[model samples]
Target: MAFSAFSMTGYASHTFELPCREGLVSATIHVKVLNGRFFEPTFRLPHALAHLEPALVKMLREALVRGTVYCTIHIGTLFALTSRPMVSSVAIAGYIEALNEIKKHLPDSPGDLISAANLVGLPHVVEFVEDPVGHEINERILADFSTVVEMLQAERVREGAVLADDIGTRLDRLETAVEQIAERSREVFAAKRQRILENLQQLVAQAGCTEDANEVQLQHAFAQIEKLDVHEELVRLRTHIASARSILGLDSIEKGKRLDFTTQEMFRETNTIGAKCGDAELGGLVISAKVELEKIREQVQNLV
Candidate 1:
């Protein structure tokens, strides 16, 4: 059978590498899904890269329909660390040229030495730009982000399949419970009719001077017994069961809301059946059926 249901919970993780500067940086993305009515995405990225949240959220909103998604991206250098700082050739050349022109007018000093180490502490001369091409790196990683989304969707589909199977089984059990209630309702109806007639006859014998039972008294008694008629309720209950089964076997992604609504209707019918039942055993069966419906509802809540 096709599984139309989908779960609100899922998990997936992926790691990717993108080139930055003269080396490569490794990054990992983790995705998690939780219950929600809409596509709510929240991300935890590096402070410098937090601006990418809007773009990532937009992509997720387009990919997912319903769920609170938590995606975290962690990036770090793949190579070993070094104490030496990288120097900017452009900045160093400008600083040396400007300093040499001023040195010609200065007093002749033997200690006017400008070493390479001195340039390391100068402004804009030394730099350690880990990811020089930030925009390009971001674009590349975001392109691979589709893989993470696919993994998360696959997990949700697996969960949805399991949920559909469980709900289907519960629906079957509910159908059986309703069937038992229908049978008991019939038995209860016959017993109620016989007992009410017997009581009416007894009343007629006690109050009337005539030997024949009072016709007006029998009519009143029959009117009271009519309240015990639960045929319509039983028929409606079976119809609701069939509808629930059909919804479960569907292949639609929007089936969650519809399935939930159908179960609520079934619950209402079960309550009506209980109220109309005068027999303790029949009332108990109706309650059992209600319990089964409740079980189905709980499982359906997780569906998409």
Candidate 2:
């Protein structure tokens, strides 16, 4: 399998059987990984092997970077008793008394209703303490476990490859959009300056100010012009696009979180550009860039 960044979602199953002194102990492990804000693991295991869950979870956590993992382990034994079931005497007595009282109301109830069969039927009345796996058997199972994990990681890598391609294509489009918006740079500055000059002229005209103060009004307008300029915003937008591409090109496993933060910065810059937009074409380009960034964000959810 190609090793690179991968999605946090995948599935894999493996069955292993070993001949032990007592019997043949077989285990079928099914692992399912789903996207989550953080890493968490839940395991469903047969009681005979439940005590080994902590070790199993630790192995998976070390192998996987992030995900909400659900792992199921079903162990079967042939020709030997792996565990001895125990009956809860207190629970059985309570269940029998409860059942007897209920039977009194139902005259048609059978005489065998409160027998041992009925007592065992009640939940938690019978229990078996999961036995710890033997060291040799545990080692064998864990060794095979690495193989299954490799299968899971392979699937994640394949998924990441596809997602990276899609995200990279969108980044290219964003770069082109940024260039076009920069090319239309003069229109935006001109519009902002015109608005500032008109506002100053209106203020002077309304107050019936003398012509000598018109120079002060012009200076004020220039200051506002400098403040509203979008060169910085455009430059940052382009830089964010470049950064995003650099991250995508890397084969590192940490791409997901980095890309997530970079896209947020890109979105911030796009919003600022949109606010300063005076031309319909620039506004449309900004909207398009947002759409592409949105798609990129969705794809990023799967990356590792």
Candidate 3:
């Protein structure tokens, strides 16, 4: 099966059991990925599983693509039940010597060093004895790591769903902006034609020529102005926008690179419209559309 697209928000927790010299030891692992960057994985293990670091890293590398990942491994018996008291023989001897020196100066009291030895010798210290589970511990850690990876991937898919919805909203806004640009393009052409006509009439009056004499010249001027029309550019821009929106709706993960390329095409078309139209108001509108497209492009970079 294909791997799910990488996402920045995800978390997984799991436990696995492996055979040990004393039966089986359970290893609990937790993995979390946030914001699509690999976070450091922290491993907590009983002394028995410390040797399994290499295997755990290998398993994690296989499962995660992007995001900060955290993995914690816990193993062995939870806590020692019967405590073993540890008394310091050396401490007792030192106390005896001090008591002898103090007795030389004063009558002995119950608080003397000699009396302290009895209490010191009975100092309760618990030593935790760990039975190394050897390779079995490593196996358990690897197994738990596998489960955590799978869980994290599922979380990534859920987060990706939300990202897809946000992208859809931005695309809708961009499409509306593109349509507005197309409409304004038509007005630009009409305005340009009217201005040219007025200029031609003013020139005829200055030259003391009749309207009939300049009729052919006026037709040629109109043809030249028509050649500069941005209607074709506007049509192409809208078509590109539609294609990009369709690409966004795809369930595939390969849409990022394609959407990035489309953003560039959209910018090119908007630039062409702004330059060819030569209307200040249309230019400002094109600029606004380009700004929105850039923002959309920035958000698309995070899409997987």
Candidate number with greatest TM-score = 1
lDDT per residue as tens, model 1, 173-220? 888887888888889889989999998877777887353447667668
lDDT (Cα) of model 2: 0.81
Query: For candidate 2, lDDT tens digit of each residue in 28-92?
Result: 88999999877799988766566678888788887787899999877676324355577888888
Over 4 Å off in model 1, which ranges? 47-52, 78-136, 209-223
Rank candidates by TM-score, best first.
1, 2, 3
Worst 10 residues of 1 by lDDT: 77-86
Name the 10 consecutive residues with the lowest summed lDDT in model 2: 75-84
Cα RMSD for predicted model 2: 8.3
Query: Over all chains combined, what TM-score does candidate 3 have?
Result: 0.58
lDDT of 3 by residue, 1-304 (tens): 1223344557787766655445655656676655443435566655555677777767666655444556666654433311223565675666667667887877755554444535554434223454544464445456666767778777767766666566666667767777787788777777778888888888888897777779877887789688658778778877887887777666665565677788888889888877776777777778788777888777666554
Give me the runs in candidate 2 sitting further than 4 Å from their true place. 1-3, 20-26, 77-81, 84-132, 191-212
Per lDDT, the best of the predicted structures is: 2
Ranking by lDDT: 2, 1, 3
